[model samples]
Target: MSYVLNDPAAFADESTDGFVAAHRSLVRRVPGGVARTTAVPEGHVAVVIGGGSGHYPAFGGLVGAGLADAAVLGNVFASPSAQQIYTVAKAVATEAGVLLSYGNYAGDVLNFDQAEQRLIAEGIPTRTVRVTDDIYSASSDERQKRRGIAGDLAVFRAAAWAAEQGLDLDAVAAVAARANERTRSMGVAFSGCTLPGATEPLFTVPEGQMAVGMGIHGEPGIGVQPLPTAKQLGELFVEALLAELPDGVTSVDGARLAVILNGLGSVKAEELFVIYATVSTELERAGATIVDPEVGEYATSFEMAGVSLTLLWLDDELESAWTAPAYAPAYRKGAVATGDTELLTDDDAAAETETIAAAATPEAAEAGRTARDVIVAIRDMIDREADELGRLDSIAGDGDHGIGMKRGTVAAARAAEAAADAGAGAGTVLALAGDAWADKAGGTSGALWGLALRAAGDVIGDTEAPSAHTVAEAVEAARAGIQNFGKAVVGDKTLVDSLVPFSDGLTARANEGAALAVAWAGAADDATRAAAATADLLPRMGRARPHMEKSLGTPDPGAISLALAMHAAASVLNHTTAQKEES
Candidate 1:
């Protein structure tokens, strides 16, 4: 169950090689094996950035037409050497001079300082900007010591634009400094990340708890706190940033900001958006005008389950630069129409009615009802066993799978009930369930559940009265679709270990002319058996495998939950059919 590369040294080299190979056209290797890009427009202030390898798009992904001119990549969580930085600076600097912008960590500062000295000796003008924007990192004395998080993007963009405008070295440095001053970022981690091929995580957090102000490279956080809802988390982050704002600004009246909601690694866009919506609304209420809002995986730490919020106070110049069109591999902007009153007021009721009507089929409706009931039962079972499942996953995983599964299942059930009460049919119910999972669940399980429900709805199609065979076919199609998307094989000790067997058993029985009741029951039984058998095997996928022996004898909670769901479906189908016959 260990990772494919256990050692950080090797993993870092392999990853950097792959990155350079993939972007060969846009990047070139300099004297110190540092990669440099010339995509930035000439005479634009050349911004050279660098950091460890694992934080994709941070040091490299932003290198392109509108962003960084060059980036020096280092080993995992380690800063590149001075020679590397100097080489990249030499390669990318234009007549306006180069701006060296990076996080304020000791390693980065030490290395970049050396590079600056070297660049000066070689007659190349250079300026340095160190990002120290994490409010939780330290108090006044320690403020300079805090590590940078996701605010590097804002600093880089502002400094680069200033440089592009042919600002002097001091002015460029001031722009970067001001951007850093206005920027404050904070992050929370639900789970730790594994170095490539590592058997264990670099750090660990307790289940149902989050580590606030956790560093990107597994540094200890300011404190551990109970996991908050996305809305609550957003409020807390916004409050923290607002509290730390310079006295004159953010006093409930004078704050104008650009907000960046960034995913650490594994957090999905849907979940990130929820946080963004909450933060944006809260800021608006606080009298802050959001000049720019960037949401995505702009910075990451190899599948870490966490997110960060970075706020930058906006001046007129900074505002213009922030909104200025810039193209990068990961960030971009296009012309957007302003204040389209007609489009905003267009009739949406008719479209909404058509959409709902299209999804209201009898067979789909019945399937949705069954799914709702099954999800409720599954949620109950998970709640009862949540602690035990957490203990099991804790040994080889982050231990949140149990809690995540319970939350996702319960959310799905509630959504289904709400949709049904609203007189929505199966497709609408399933869509609601998917959205709930996407909202409440923050990791791999949530994504899978969301995908599964959506695929099931798609398979049911437009039919109002699908036969039993159609139902079975839809189930099979869902199983296949999940398998295709996830790429988990039967023996991987993944949910597929149970689901594949169940799908096959059901298909066999259905094809043999067995009653739907008998077929579903058999399928549920087989799934349960297969899930139990997974205890004897080791997991080879997801975050669990890193714990090695931890999961050897414990069934994957996902697999067990899937079996429970099938059994619940069997009960619902049998009861419904008997009542129909009697009537």
Candidate 2:
């Protein structure tokens, strides 16, 4: 039940703009997300954190002196693109190596891992520590598979504190890793969450019943039962969290703990306080001493009627780190020493770009013009089908794919136009567009699109127009790049399904001496068939994995989107050749 929104598609971007506008003192706008307005000190590890946009303060709200240096935001319930992650890391990195941290989710793992590699390749050292503390997501034997929940605060705070204390990158990562092992969280939902334009929530709970062991991404809980009283709910949380004591503690006696009772969106503060009161009493009964107990929102789903409890078992070092001062937009502790608060903006770059000019050969310049038209067609198609794409995603995954694709394609279209106008080559235009797509659409789809576009561009050298063989090779490379980078196989019910078929069809047709335009059209037909066939396959990766049954009758949004884009691109290629004939 989101009450305020202009266009549902623009909700995430508009909200991010508003967040920075209201908190200029603490965080300033950056390409990926927000950075602390105060200068990032050199000779210290930079802690960068991120995830989907709906979690708010969990990511961006935690950017400050004693927390994250920057937060990379993505679309609602999606992970930030690899380019966004890399750009933010580059912006904030100092002499010391950078540390990238986020919750354990498929998209986050894919994007962050790629960013880490890119940073390392650029000779800027980087490390990563994924937060995994949700006790319900997996068994103790499969701890690495667990998802992170409100417990992310404990890990991020500890790691950021270590960085502030001048710890090296490995030491900082170790601190976060230890914190993750000692922390455990569990949540229950009284009702499901509805996206901005949706008429109903992602899932529903019957009146007087509640869902237990739920995830934050509009996913239903593992079990359902009648609602309990506040004290009973407290007992449930404690019992669930304590059942798996994280391998270190055999008993709760004399153990120091940091307890957090989090409200997931629609839950009220007063109600939370009532629950925490009983929660504290229960902890005392278990002989666990509560230290710095926090009771408020930290991580959240969009207006989900839910609550989560987190416990961080603390040793002496963890205690000191936990008590260290912090001042972020959402969370705060003791006062922080103020430093330079200067901000960077586009105005700072305008002067630097004044002398730049695009470089291209005559044939390549014509190819660049055609690339511009193709990008425009892609953007228009996305805008036209944005709502439908989102609806399809909502059937199993979070309903943000359409808007994310629309944002990426629109940004790509604009960048391609600018590059063509400046006399850039086809490869340069595609490269610029790819960067924009990743920057604007921070998600798994965005990252994959970036990989596809960049790989294709690499084959289309700037000196000449690409031949039919070159075009076929570009398609094969794009498909291979996506498959390798995303680690999704053909039967995973992802875009890889259509992408592989399209690439094969193009290469086969091209080898038989067909024209580039005709080969691409035939390939597009192959993609359409493959995408439609995905309706029968169960999802093996990404957010849709949890709701496999819901997706059985519907085509994967990613696969369908890729097919549609290829169809549009085929039209563009044919139109270009037809115009050349007429002229």
Candidate 3:
């Protein structure tokens, strides 16, 4: 559906580069994303906002004087890596601190929390406030479980305003949290979005029907209804938001609200204004005062025919913060004063070249080469199966799983091959591969895989070749890392569904004194069976939870991909065994 792209995998990066080029005066290139070109005062808290790339003006386009000081850009519909977030935060951080803000999504939460910990460990004060404003995502009582939508604008603006006022990190974080709590949003989609190079959209609504409560990441809506006129849609938006006011607000009457009528891509400004026309009238009829109503694209899905409405119940402080001046590529509010600017000298620090160490012995070097071969097999397998995996994911998620897996495995394979050529040990090879996978993939699966690989590598050290027992132990370590990091159990219908069985099978075979190849083959079989079993279960975690019923007949994409990787690794080990037997 994305017609004007060379390689789908490179679209996010290429688009970011072009964006930076176009907004050179307002923003400059940073490691993970973009930062303001203007100067900031010393001891002022820096407000850093980020999410996936599909939402224009939300992340990159909001980097300027009164919005975000920096924005971390992730792959399309994928959260950025923790390393990327840390790099971007460090690039914009001042003596006071840094406040990392983003939408409330699983991947974003995991990576941002990791980055927050790393920043604090290095003595940089860092805080995070996740925006949860989509009223339809969850029941009002379960507000914390709600997803963030177009309400990101209000939260980001409030936080940035507090920062611009020279507030410390804690104060800025409080403002962002307050903004999130006060904001409520709901959306509807007439159609779904397609990923680049994909022949079909992720999901589609029937003609003359619309999906209500759809997500920005190509997730299908919770419910469907016949499409209505612009006026009827506006009434729907106003009625839904007013049904439940934030805790502080007692009544909708006399309530001052900051309204955002956001077009979720393909719904142009004129169409939005037509909807806003009715939305404003409805709000006024409800006896609520609208303040600075925004009618345009703020947070968007790639070419999704949808619109979301956000209402921020403003108190005195929130109103003042909301009215503050801002200047950005996609958003400009009032007059913003300028100052002398200087380019970041440490921008190139993120580009430091990696050097692989020589193995301690020839056996370790040979093991590293074997690891590289295994990674290459995994990469090839993913390339072959990506489309099917993505199809499964599209049933309940953003449908980027296959592409994400391919990106990770390809990057991992390259890193593994380079490490093996440098005579690195198996441990170093796997660890470097994991880092590359995470850095390039940038999603929930990417983070988990990278962590699992690194954990396994840590157990297998760089000193010597691994025995069957050592390999089993390493696999167990990997399984443990995934469970601990992702917090998913077997029935959760995640990759852990397959990984746990595979790990247990490997440990059992190794304990029975089986050879590495035989043990791995048996474990791979277990993983394949476990992956297939997931088709009978409903997803209880991650992005698929909201659409659990839709995924009932399909296996989790993560589980399938893990099983495929396990089988690929087994094939490599079997080939090595065969070669040894021949010799």
Q: Give the best candidate by TM-score.
A: 3
Each model's lDDT: 0.71, 0.86, 0.90
For candidate 3, write residues 1-583 as lDDT tens digits.
Answer: 6879988889999999999889888888888888887656788999899998889977999998889999999999999988899989988788899999998888888788889999999999999999999988889999988889999999999999999888888888998999999999999999999887788999999999999999999999999999999989999999999998998899888999999999998988888989999999989988999998888999998899999999999999899988888899999999988656565532543655777899999988989999999999999999999999999999998898998889999999999999999999899999999988988888898888888888888888788999999999999999988888778999999999999999999999999999999999999999999999999999878888888899998999999999999999999999998998999
lDDT per residue, candidate 1, 405-459, as tens digits? 7666777889878766555656566766765664355245555666677676666
Predicted candidate 2 versus true structure: per-residue lDDT over 1-583, tens digit per residue? 8899998767777898999888887887777677777656778899999998888677899998778988988877778888778878887887788999899887788789989999999888899999888877767887887888899899989989999999988899999899999999999999989877778787888999998877888877767899999999999999888787766788888889999899999999999999998999988999999999999999988899999999999988788878888999999998877755556552221211222146557899888888888889999999899889988887777777887898899889988999889887778888788877876786788888977887888888677898889989987888888888788999999999999999999999999999999999999999999999999999988777756777898999999999999989999999999998999
Model 2 scores worst on lDDT over the 10 consecutive residues at: 347-356
For all predictions, the C-alpha RMSD in Å is 20.6, 2.8, 1.3
Query: Which model, 2 or 3, shows the larger TM-score?
Result: 3
TM-score of 2: 0.91
Count clashes in each candidate, considering only residues at least 3 apart in sequence or on different chains.
6, 0, 0
lDDT of 3 at 63: 90
TM-score of each: 0.56, 0.91, 0.98
The regions of model 3 sitting more than 4 angstroms off are 341-350
